[model samples]
Every structure is written in C-alpha cells, then in structure tokens.
Target: MANHVSSEKRARQTEVRRLRNRANMSAMKTTVKKVLEAVQKKDFSNIDALLRDAQSVIAKTRQKGSIHKNNMARRISRLNAFVNKARNAQ
Candidate 1:
C-alpha cells in the first residue's frame, strides 16, 4: 500500500530491520538459556566462559537497538545471581 516512493523504500527497509532484530533477539534468548542450563545443572566449571559469551551477546543486542540496555543489564544481573548461587551451593 505504500504509494509514495519514500514510504515504499522505508517499508522495505523496515522489513529487513524487523527480521534482523528478530534474529538478534532470538539469539540473545538462546544464549541466555544456555547459561541458565549450566546453572540449573549445578555445573559452574564452564559457567564463567558461558557468562562471557552471554555478556558479548547482550552487549551486541543492546548496541544494535534490539533490546534496551537496562533490560540487558537486568538479564545479566539475574544470570549472575543464579550462577553465584549455584556455585555456592557446594
């Protein structure tokens, strides 16, 4: 329905951006799940490395405007809490 040339171009760009953002969000969620799974299994040996990878994913997702920086911070906060608790349970 975008009749104007500008609008048509914008619509195309928006679709591409939407797909990219969705992929970024999905990747973030998957990485977060991987970290949580490590914690859930009470395996902290590899958690530090997993946390580092997750941090990178979070930062990139935030930088790309896919998710709010504060939301990412909150996620990291909860993830670390779980990690620490799991580690201390020993």
Candidate 2:
C-alpha cells in the first residue's frame, strides 16, 4: 500500500525502472531470436546484420547490469561461431 510518503515515491520509481528493464529485456530477447533463426535457416546474407544487432543488444544489456558480462560473451561467441561455420560451409 506504501503508506509512507517515501515508500510511495519508491514504489513509483520501482515501476518506472521495471518498465525500462522489461523493454530492454524484450529487445534483447528479440535480437537473440532473430540471430538464432538466421543461423538455423543459414541465411548467410543477413547473418552479419543480425549478428551486429544481437551483439549490440547483448553488450548494452551487459553494460546496464541486466545480464552478466560472461554470459553475454558466451552467447556472442556461440553466435559468431555459427556465423563463421555457415560462411565456411557455403
């Protein structure tokens, strides 16, 4: 209920932060999904663009403290490998 005035202000702040984080997380997830789909279909032409977008999202999320840096790095590494393998396969 946030009976305290300060608590009410904090509640509002929390809501704002939650909304921002949700949007960022959704963007990150969408970027990852696009990358994975491109990898699965072996859409080589779009891979570079998708990879860059995904990498940027991942780096931003890591910087914002939404995700661990190592986790982001691992995902980026896997995505890069997928792109590389697809290129070599062609």
Instruction: List RMSD in Å for every model shown.
Output: 1.1, 2.0
lDDT value, candidate 1, whole model: 0.91
Each model's lDDT: 0.91, 0.87
Report clash pairs, candidate 1: none
Q: Candidate 1 vs. truth: CA RMSD?
A: 1.1
Ten residues in sequence with the least summed lDDT for candidate 1: 81-90
The TM-score values for the models, in the order shown, are: 0.91, 0.80
lDDT of 2 at 87: 81
lDDT of 1 by residue, 1-90 (tens): 899999999999999999999999999999989999988887778889999999899889999999998998998888888888878887
List model 2 lDDT by residue over 1-90, tens digit each.
999999999999999988887888899999989988887887878788888999999899888877788988998898788778878887
